[model samples]
Every structure is written in C-alpha cells, then in structure tokens.
Target chain A: MKELEDRIRQDGIVREGNVLKVDSFLNHKCDVALYDQMGAEWARLFEGKKVDKILTIESSGIGIACVAATHFHNAPVVFARKTESKNLDGEQYRTQIKSYTKGRTYEVIVAKRFLERGEHVIILDDFLAMGCALNGLLEICEEAGVVVEGIGIAIEKGFQPGGKSLRERGYQVESLAIVSGMNAETGEIDFA
Target chain B: MKELEDRIRQDGIVREGNVLKVDSFLNHKCDVALYDQMGAEWARLFEGKKVDKILTIESSGIGIACVAATHFHNAPVVFARKTESKNLDGEQYRTQIKSYTKGRTYEVIVAKRFLERGEHVIILDDFLAMGCALNGLLEICEEAGVVVEGIGIAIEKGFQPGGKSLRERGYQVESLAIVSGMNAETGEIDFA
Candidate 1:
C-alpha cells in the first residue's frame, strides 16, 4: 500500500472535478510489476478464504483481476460485462450499476452458469467511488447464492463514501491506496 | 496450443450466426490457469523479440493481455479505452474499431505517453475475425511510432479473413487455435 500511495503521488495527476489521472501506470496504461505486488498483497490479505473465483467488471478491472487471480492459487477469473454482446448468450444475472467515471448507469451482467452456489468469490476492481459497481457485483453474488469472501480494490476515493460505507456494512474491503482529498489548482493529493 | 484447442473443444459452444461461445473459460468466465499456459505459449512463440509492452483493447482483452504481460518479463500492459471517461484527460491516440460481437463500432483511445516510439509491442486479443480491433491497434501503434513486433490472439476464426489478411500483409500473427468451420445445427467445430 505504501508503494502504491507513493506511485500515486509521483505519477497521479489531479485534474478538474476531482478526476485523478493514473493513465501512466494504473488504468489506461498499466504497470504489471505494481499489479503483481498488489496481487500478492491481496492474496496475503485474503489468505485462508479459499477463494474459488475472482469477479470483476470489464475494462479496467480485468488486468488487475487477472493478476490478482494468479496470486489466489491461480483461481479462475470471471468478469461481469457492462455491454450487451452477441456472444453473451444463455441465462445471465443482470443488474444496473452506476459509473461515476462514465457518468451513467449501464446494465452489468454475468452468465449464470459461471457462479456456482456456495462458491467463495473475491470481488476486485480498479477503483471504488460511489460503490455502485461493487454493489452490483454483490447483488449478483447474492442472486447466484455465492459467498463473497471480501472486496479488493487498487484505489479508493476516500473523499467519497464508498469505502467507508462498505466497511460500515461489515464488508471486508481492502484498498491499496485511498485518496482522502485532492486539490486541482495546487496539484496536491491527501492519502488516507 | 494443443491444450487450448482441447479446452475449446470441450467447453466451447457453437451458436447461431457463427458465434463460438467460449465464455466458460475464455471471455466471460476465464480460466486463469489456462491463460497462464497461454501466456507462456505466447512467450515461447515470440521468443527473442523483446516485447516492451503488451497492448490490448478493453473488456475481453484485458485479462488475457495482463496475464500475457507477466510472461513477457512483466512488460507493462496498456489497454485502449472503449469509452470516454472524465479521468482520461491528455493527448491520446484514437481510432474507430468495429466490434462484430457487439454489433457496433466504438472509439478506442490510448494515452500518448504509454506507447513510446520505437518500443516493441505485442497486441493481444481474445478473438480475431474481421481484425477490425487488431487493425485499430496497429493504427494506434503507427500513430505512436511504436514497432509492432507481432500480434497474439487466443482464437482466430480461420474462416474469416482477418488472420489470413494480416499474415498476407507480412505481419507475424500467432493464434492458439483457429476455427476453420463451425456448424450451429450439428454443434461441431473444425480447427485449423
């Protein structure tokens, strides 16, 4: 987490509207070395949970989730799709999730056959803000009757209430770096 | 490659309209173990070529790309963004990619800083048919002046012209499995 926070401080940019651009190493462009470390950290944090699978949304979450899945004994990864594709056939669990980054709500879905009942799943994502996406995953897990061991996130906006609210709800949410606040004008970031 | 072909035969389903659904272990629900083998295979195929980075489009390509990045000496992975986000502020290389599965076209963008000029990149994707996405990636690479060492794909519809065209164009393309033909009614596939 210290390494991640330092990397954020060194490379992350604070833009207008509280947007943090980590395109250099996190989201758009990725640092596999950093992701490997993060994966190891998640494996350590969620050790002994017997994670059967890793669930995450598409795009930003896929890379981190895949690397993290490698740490969990190479647990199989299943990513929820945010778009409707012709290849996505069969019965699926669908839910509406809001994306603060995209500024809209989209239908998120996962094939029903992928999530077996009584399986322990670890939900991972690149960033957590309003927790809508995380909540949507949790909702799908409940519908599938799977046990969510915990939630893992690379970065959390502490200024927002997603991490705090999830913790208050008794969810074991582990975030590598939490940005408490950011100043666009001064280009300063406060880490929690 | 044999393992991937076998796995595909075992789990891949052929649907109407020439759709080969391998969601059980390739796209929707991914088998990280299989992907690790794939990563190793790609490393073997592209041996001696220093792959500076692994470039992929988002959603389906991210997981495979990340896993593949680990095998390339932990080369940094950069995924093109499918949609505009608030955090994506900066100069970027943009291209329009047509998605057959999605039945639509989307603008793919990568930050200008990620792909350095003269750096060798291996573009990885989950599937290759018409090669629109692959071409978009090549376009971005050209715009960035990066040398595309090769293209790596998990599955290629050999019946389609994408892989054939790329190879004809003097680009080295390595695919794990090539589906020569599929019958939706009989539910059979012929691999090339």
Candidate 2:
C-alpha cells in the first residue's frame, strides 16, 4: 500500500471538483508491476475466502482484474460489459449504475453463462468513489444467485462514501490506497 | 499453440452468421492460465525487440494485454479508450476504425504522454477478423510516432482478410489459433 501511495503522490495530480488523476500509471496507461503488487496484496487479504472468480466492469477494471486473476489461483476474470454487442445475445444478469467518472448512467451486463448459481466471486476495480460500478456488480451477482465473497480496490477516495457504504453492508472491502483529500491549487494529495 | 487450439476446439461454439463464440473462455469469461501462457509466448516471440510498451484497445483487449505485459518485462500496458473521460483531457493521438463485432465505428484515443516518439510497441487483441482494431492501433502508433514491432492475436478468423492484409503490408502478425472455417449447422470448426 505504501508503494501505491508513493506512486500516486509522485505521479498523481489533482484537478478541480476533487478529481485525482493517476492515469500516468493506474488507469489510462497501466503499470503492470504495480498492478501485480496490488493483486498479490488482495490475494493475501482474501486468502481463505474461496473466491471462485474475479468480477469487474469492462474497460478500466479489466486490466487490474486480469492481473489479479493470476494471483487468485488463476481464477477466471469475468468483466461485465457496458455496451451491448451482437455477440452478447443470451440470458443475462443486469444492473444499472450511475457512472461517476463519465457523469452518466448506464446498465452493466454479464451473460448468465459466465456467472453460475452458487458460485463465489470477488469484485475488483481501479477506483472506488461513489461505488456505482461495485454496487452494480454486486446486484448482478445477486441476480445470478452468486455469493459475494469480498471486494478489492486499487484506490479509494476516502472523502467519498463508496468504500464506507460497502463496509457498512458487512462486505469485506480492501483498498490499497485511500485518498483523504487533495489540493487542486497546490497539487498536493493526502492519503488516509 | 496446441493448448490454445485444443481449448478452442473443446469450448468454442460456431454460431449463426459466421460468428464463432469463444466467450466461454476468451473474451467475456477469461481463463487466466491460458492468458499467462499466451503472455509468455508473446514475450518469446517478440524477444529482442525491446518492446517499450504493449498496446491494445479497451474492454476485451485489456485482459490479454495486461496478462501479456507480465511476460514483456513488466513493460507498461496502454489501452486506447473508446470513449472520452474527464481524466483524458489533453493532447491525444486518435484513429478511427470500424468494429466488426459491434457493427460500428468509433475513434480510439491514446494520451500523447503515454506513447512517446520512437517507442517500440506490439499490439495485442482477443480476436482479429477484419483487422479493424489492429489497423486502428497501427494508425495511433503512427500518430504518436511510435514504431509497431508486430501484432499478436489470440484468435484470427483465417476465413477473413484481416490477417492476410496485415501480412501483405509487411507486418509481423502472429495468431495463436486461426479458424479456417465453421459449420453452423453441425457446429463444427476447422482451424487453419
């Protein structure tokens, strides 16, 4: 976690509206080495949880989730698709969540074949702010009758309520770096 | 490659309208172990190329690209995003390509900072049919003034012209599994 926080402090920048940009290593361009450490840390945190699969949303989450899959006994990484394609025609488990990053709302879907009944899963994401993506993934798991074992996140905005809300729901949530606050003008980041 | 072909033969389904669905293990639901092997194979193939980075488009490609990054000396993995986000406000290298699977065209953008001039990159993807995604990646690389070492594809529809076109253009394109044809009625697949 210290490594992540250090990397964020070194390369992450703050913008208006409390937006912290870590795309230099975290999102847009990924640092595989850092992701490996985060995956190992998550695996350590949920060692005995019997996580049958790793669930995440498409686009950004896929990178961390796939690398984390290797650490989770090569658990199959299943990412929920945000856009519908001709290939995704079948019975599906659906959940709607607002996109805090894009400032829009959209439904996240996963084909029912990927998630089976009674399977165990862990939700992984790049960032957990408002928890829209995480909640949507949890709802899909519930609809498919899958058991939610835990959640892992690379970064959590501590000033936001997403991580706190999940913890209150009795969900085992672990985040590597928690951002307490940020100064846009000074370009300083505070980690919790 | 034998392992990949065997897995494809076992789980891949031949759907209607020339669609071969390997969603069971390739795209939607991923087998990380197979991906690790692929990453290793790609590293071996592109060995000595000194690939500074690995590039791919978002969603499905992110999974394979991230895994492949581990084998590439932990080289940074940069995925071209399909949509614009608040974090991605900067000079960008853009390219337009049609999505064969989705029946659409969209601009793929990579932040100018992630890809610098003279960087060597290899493009990775889940599937190569019409080569739309690969071509888009090549265009982006050119825009950023980066050199594309080659292209690695998990599955290539040999019946299509994507692979041939790239090869004819003098690109080193390697595919783990090449499907020559399929029988929708019999649900049979032939590998090239």
Candidate 3:
C-alpha cells in the first residue's frame, strides 16, 4: 500500500474536477510488478475469505485483476463487458453503469454460466470514486446469487462518497491508496 | 501448445458463422492457471528477444498481455484504449480498426509516452483472425519507431488470411493453437 501511495505521489497528475491521472503506470501503461505486489497485499488482507472467482470490469480492471489473480492461487477472473458484442450470446446478467470519466451510461454484463449460485467472489477495480461501477458489479453479483467476499480497490478517492457509502453498507472494502484530497493547481495529493 | 489445443477442443464452442467461442476459459471468464501456461509458452517461443514492453489492446487482450508480461521478466504492459476518455490527455498514437465481432470500426489510441522510440516490444492478443487489430497495433508501433520483436497470439484461424499474411510479412508469429477448420453442426475442429 505504501509503495502504491508513493508511486501515485511521484507520478499521479492532479487535474481539475478531482481527476487523478495515473495512466502512466496504473491504467493505460501498466506496471505488472506493482500489480503483482498489489495482488499479494490483497491476498494478505483477504487471507481467510473464500475467493472462488475474481470479478472485474473490462478495459482497466482486466489487467489488474488478471495479474493479481496469480497471487490468489490463480482463481479464474470474470470481467464484465461494458459493450455488447456478437461474441457475447446466451443468458447474461446485465446492469447499467454510468461512467464518470467517459460521461455516459453503458450496459455491463457477465455470462450467467460464469457466476454460479453460492460462489464466493471478490470484486477488484482500478479506481473507486463515485462507486457507480462497483454498484453495477454488485448488482450483477447479487443477481447471480453469489456471495460477495470483499472488494479490493487499487485507488479510492476518500473525499468522494463512493468509498464511504460502500463502507457504510457493511462491505469490507480494502483500498490500497485512498486519496483524501487533491489539488489540481498545486499537484499535491493527500492520502487517507 | 498441445495443452491449449486440448483445452480448446474440450471447452471451446463451435458456433454458427465460423465462431469458435473460447470465452469459457480464454476471454470472458479467464482461467488464470491457463493464462500462466500461455505466458510460459510465449516466453519459450519468443525467447532470447529483448522484450522492453508488452503492447496490447483493451478489454480481452489486457488480461492476457499483463499476465504474460510476468514471463518476460515483468515487462511493463501498455494497452491501447478503444474509446476516448477524460483521463487520456496529451499526444497519442491513434488508429482505426474494424472489429469482426463488434461489427463496427472504432478508434484506438495509446499515449505517446508509453511507446518510446527504438524500444523493443512484442504485441500479444487473444485472437487474430483478419489481423485488423494486429495491423492497427503494428501501425502504431511503426509510427512510434518501436521494434516489434514478434507477435504472440493465443489462437489463430489458419483458414483466415490474417496469420498467413502476417507470416508473409516476415514477422515471427507464434500461435499457440492454429485452427485450420471447424464445423458448427458437428462441433469438429481441425488443427494445423
């Protein structure tokens, strides 16, 4: 966690409207070593939890979840696709999610066969700000009747309501680095 | 490679319109153990080549490429995003790609800073059929002045012109499993 916070401070760019650009190492250009370490930390945190599967969203979370999965005894990772494709057919659990960055609402779905009833799953994602994406994933998990073991987040905006609301809802959310506040002009970030 | 072919035969679905769906283990619901094996296989195939970075596209390729990066000494993985987002700012290498599955063409972009000039890279993807996606990635690699050491593909439709054309281009392409033919009605697949 300290390593991630340090890396964020060194490379994260704070922009207007609380936008933290970590594309250099977190999302777009990934550091697999750091991702492995994050996975190890999550494994340590959720040691006793039964993680039959790892669920994530497409695009950004796919890399982190897949790499982190190596630390979890290579648990299968099921990423919810944001867009509907010809390849995705058959029964699926679908939900709508609004993207803060992309500024649009899109449907996210997972094959019904992928998430079976009574399966224990841990949801992982890169950023947790408004919690809309997590909520959508939670909806799919709920529909599948799978047990929510825990939530592992790489970075969370602490000043935002997403993390707080989830914690209040009694979900065991473990965010590696929580940005309490950030300054766009000065480029200073405060971690919780 | 034999292991991959065997798994494909067991779990891969032969759908109508020449679609071989390996979503059970490869893309949608990922088998991390199998992914680790793929990474090792690519490492064995592309051995002795300088892999400064691993380049891939978003969604499906991100997971495979990131997991495979571990086999290449934890080489950083850079995934080109398909859509424009607020997080992606500054100069970029952009290309247009037609998706056979999605049935539409979309713009893909990678931040200019990720792919440096003269850096050696290996482009990895989940599937290579018509080679539209790989060609786009290669175009970006050319514009960035990066040396493409090789291309690693999990599965290639040998019946399609993509793999053959790429091989004709004088690039070392290692496909774990090459499917020469498959029957949707009989569910029989032939490997080349």
Q: Please name the candidate that would achieve the greatest TM-score relative to the true structure.
A: 3
Residue B165, model 3: lDDT of 97
The DockQ scores of all candidates, in the order shown, are: 0.85, 0.90, 0.93
List model 1 lDDT by residue over A14-58, tens digit each. 999889988799888889889999999999999888799999998
Supply candidate 2's per-residue lDDT for B32: 93
| Ordering by DockQ | 3, 2, 1
> Any runs in candidate 3 off by more than 4 Å, and if so which?
A84-90, B84-90
Which docking class does model 2 fall in?
high
Which candidate would rank higher by DockQ, 1 or 2? 2
Return the lDDT, model 3, position A95: 88
Model 3 TM-score is: 0.97
Q: In angstroms, how far off is A28's CA in candidate 2?
A: 1.3
By summed lDDT, the worst window of 10 consecutive residues in model 1 chain A runs over A82-91
* RMSD over all Cα atoms, model 3: 1.8
Clashing pairs in 2: none
Tell me the spans in candidate 2 whose CA falls farther than 4 Å from its real position. A84-90, B84-90
